[model samples]
Target: MADPVPALVATGVAHTFGETRALDGVSLTVGARERVALLGRNGSGKTTLLRVASTQLRPDAGRVEVAGADVVGQPDVVRRHLGVVFQSPALDPALTAREALRLQAALVRIDRAEVAGRVADALADAGLADRAGDRVGTFSGGMVRRLDLARGLLHRPTLALLDEPTTGLDVLARDAFWAALDRRRADGAQVVATHAMDEAARCDRVVIVDAGRVVADGTPDALTSALGPDALWLDTDDADALAATLRGEGHDARAVVDRVLVVSPSARDLVAPFYARPDVRALSIQPPTLADVFAAVVGGRGGR
Candidate 1:
């Protein structure tokens, strides 16, 4: 038997804004029921890629398939399989939560008879039932995002494209947002674009983009396990002596402030002997972190 069709497929996708190459031959896939997080710096092409896959913007090159429908030639069919929540706020300020949801259902061509029920269920799922009649303009940032997500799900699309969905949410609101997302895990596949590592940690896999190319892609544990920029740290008043001693011991060690950092693959072998020293104040091993992976892959500029 042939392999089943993937939930989403983008191959050699490329796009440009004037001379700036927004997406350059990028490719990705999300399997059924899988959650993939797209992470990168401020202008690293995450948004452009999402826009292309969601069928909101046509790419200059390559192909995208959403639920086995072509994004370029069968855009309407692709829309039937996609629900996107953009980074920017796109809700109308004047419409109440209920009114906005009703409009969304109509826009998505939901049956008129089912629109009311679907809207009610979406709002309730988003925890907006108590404030269904309130204008969206009066809601907090988190509340607005929740309502936006509710509108996205009203049509029951098979693939969800979320771009920075929890960028500015507070702790409690962020938790609520993830709770809503968790409820949909068994129903469809999700492609979440985010900067929060904690959120990425919850995803089944992560794909990091930079300069319009995919720099790294893997599960969090898998990426973290790969040997990289891993460091063995040593703290002591005699930083120079420690560095010299480690070098004499054939370890590539360097001093930063009052500590020596060892980055070689053999750093772990020195742990036992270092702790045996009387002057060794403290020792800690930092496994390769997601940030470290980003830095190593994306030109050493870390964070987000």
Candidate 2:
């Protein structure tokens, strides 16, 4: 049987703002029930790619498809299946949560009879049902973020295009917000573009971008594991001495200031003896982290 259609797909997407290239031949796919985080630092093309994918900005070159329809060719149909929540404050402060959702439903051309029920469902999904009657200006940042998410649900989109959707939320609130997103996993796909590493860690997979290109893509654990070996960190003023001794003992060591570190494939087996050394003031074993993996893959390159 043929492979099932992906929930979202983009190929050879290229975009530029005047002379500056914002995206360079980017491609990605997210299947149904999968969540992919677009991980990148500021100005790394995350937002630009998201805009193209969401049909907010047409790309200079590329193809984008959401839920089986081409974005450029079928904008109206694509827009119906996609819910976009950008980082900016898109809601009207003067309008109540109910009013904003109602307006959104009207704008999206939802059946007039279903508007109230959809608004109620979205409010409950975002945990904003109680505050639906209150003006959005009175809501907290987290509440506003949630309401923004609720508004996106007005049409029950099949793909959620979120650019830093959790920006202003606290840890607890962010977790709660993700839990809300978790509930939607079974319906379709979620693509989150974010600079926050921890937030990206919450997704099912990560796609790191740098210099207008996609640098890496994998599950957080898979990427971390693929970095190879555990790290042994030694803290002491005698870093040079420690390196010398470790090298003498058949261990590769790199001395940086007061710390000596070694990336050893056999670190787990060899680390037990280092604790008994007199010159080793401190010894710590660090398993490969996603940050370390990300740094290795995308750090130290100049901006685009």
Candidate 3:
């Protein structure tokens, strides 16, 4: 038998905003029930790709399909199969939690008979059944985010496109949102655009984008493994300068955020020079992580 179609597919997708090329020849595929992270720093085209895949923005070049429906040619069809939760809150402050979901169901054209049942299920799934009659404005940031996620699921889409769904949420709130999302979307595929390394680490696959291009794609462990077994970290006053110095000396080193990271097979042996440096404040060694892989791939720029 022939293979089943993927939940999402993008080929040579390119999009430009004026002079800034947001997505440059990007391509990727998400299998059924797979959770893939569109991992990148800000301005890395993660959101652009999501928008294109969701059919909110057409690409300048290339093609995108959601559940075999062409995003451009059959955008309405794609919309039916896609559940999108954007970074911004779409809830109305004056509307009650139940009202918000009811509106969403109407907007999506859910049958009147099913709307009540679906709304009830959504409210319960969001843990907002008790607050169904309460105004959305009265809810916390986490509650509002959860409602938004619930709204996205009214259609039971085949693919979920999440663009930094927990951007301003606290750690606990972020965890709760993911739990709710996991419970609701377990049977569907997910493409989440986020800059959080920890979030990307939890995904089945990570597609790292930089400068509108896909720099790397692999499982988090597999991607980090390419950096070798160990990573040496150097805390210095001038991470960029120290990174440049190390690079000049032929070390595969780069400055990530506030530290200079060196990934090599013999990570311990290369730490002596930094350990003796007056400007170097601390030194440590650990297994390679996604951040280290990002530093190496993006050339030390755009740290999480």
Best by lDDT: 3
Ranking by TM-score: 3, 2, 1
Clashes of each: 0, 0, 0
lDDT of 2 by residue, 125-172 (tens): 889989889999999888888888778766867888889888878888
Worst lDDT 10-window in candidate 3: 295-304
- Per-candidate Cα RMSD to the true structure, in Å, reads 4.7, 4.2, 2.4
Q: lDDT of model 2 at residue 138?
A: 99
Question: What is the alpha-carbon lDDT for the whole of candidate 3?
Answer: 0.89
Alpha carbon lDDT of each predicted model: 0.84, 0.84, 0.89
1 or 2, greater by TM-score: 2
* TM-score, predicted candidate 2 vs. hidden true structure: 0.83
Candidates' TM-scores?
0.83, 0.83, 0.91
Ranking by lDDT: 3, 1, 2
For model 1 the local lDDT of residue 119 reads 85
- Misplaced by over 4 Å in model 3 are 236-250, 255-259, 277-281, 302-304
- lDDT per residue for candidate 1 within 88-131, as digits (tens), equals 76789899999999988888899999988998898899999999
